[model samples]
Target: MAVAPSFKLPNVGPGPDPLSLSALAADNEFVLLLLQRDYHCGNCRKQVQVFADWYDEFHERNTEVVSIVPEPRERVRSWQEEYDLPYPLCADPEAAAGEEYDQPVRFGPLGRFSDLLGRMPKAVLLDCRDGDPTICYTHEGSSTWDRPELEEVFDAIDEQR
Candidate 1:
């Protein structure tokens, strides 16, 4: 389940672009897929900033990194500008992509109202070569303050090469 079989979601970055797994490797040799909590989550914003800081380093190794959140495109735009993110951003306001990616979500004190809960942070590395996308690694954040280590992420990237 850690390995993404195939997933395609709409990009809310520069334009209304289609980010498809079918054509992944062709567009970029590899992609570091990031699944984030909603914009309301302060931890999520900080996590994005960390990624933004290391964006160039990832690209230098031929890995294109992008982030996705369960938020509307308009809000996503604001988040990108606020963080000064350099990579493409994807919006899944309905949380459809989050469910597709099997990203965990929580509701609140009452279980009845939990389905629409915010997202949990996570990341996966995809080896998109030979016109096929393969999941090389997956990192799950266990808590609000959890974040994947840059060294571990880069190690996974190096493993792909």
Candidate 2:
């Protein structure tokens, strides 16, 4: 059973420089979190686009969706504009939050590739109560292509209500 680690990662956004799942949530709110591999993954880009396309629906459910990327601030900021992401995006170049959330990483050949190349994409629904973050749903895989279905991700958000 994987658990969500309470973490506040620095983001590439303007006002909300640092975004934390716990802080973003209400007294008892569920946050839909999307963890991306990096700026390079095609699958990651597709998944993000999917989320962008359905951003309104997620909002209609009163669910807050956020994406975390292991890219530098400059690159992440550029990506934010490129995606025109309706949600928050945090930069984790050091992969600190990824390590805390137990986000997967490809080992063996893929792992040997490069620091920015070995990341494993993941998604999670976190229920933030008071100041603690609990994992309501978690999706971790060894390959970048391995991702949770949008339906399942939205379903997890619906569970909060």
List, residue by residue over 4-56, the lDDT tens digit for candidate 2: 67668887653266886656775336677778888787887788778879988
Clashes of each: 1, 0
Which whole-number lDDT from 0 to 100 does residue 71 have in model 1?
Answer: 76
Provide C-alpha RMSD values for all models, in order.
2.8, 2.5
TM-score of 1: 0.84
TM of each candidate vs. truth: 0.84, 0.85
The model with the greatest lDDT is: 2
Candidate 1 residue spans exceeding 4 A from truth: 1-5, 14-16, 106-118
lDDT of 1 by residue, 26-125 (tens): 7777888788877787877887788889888998988878788777788887887787777778887776766776676556454223423545678888
lDDT of 1 at 104: 60
Hey, what RMSD does candidate 1 come out at?
A: 2.8
**Candidate with the greatest TM-score versus the true structure:** 2
Instruction: Give the lowest summed-lDDT range of ten residues in model 1.
Output: 109-118
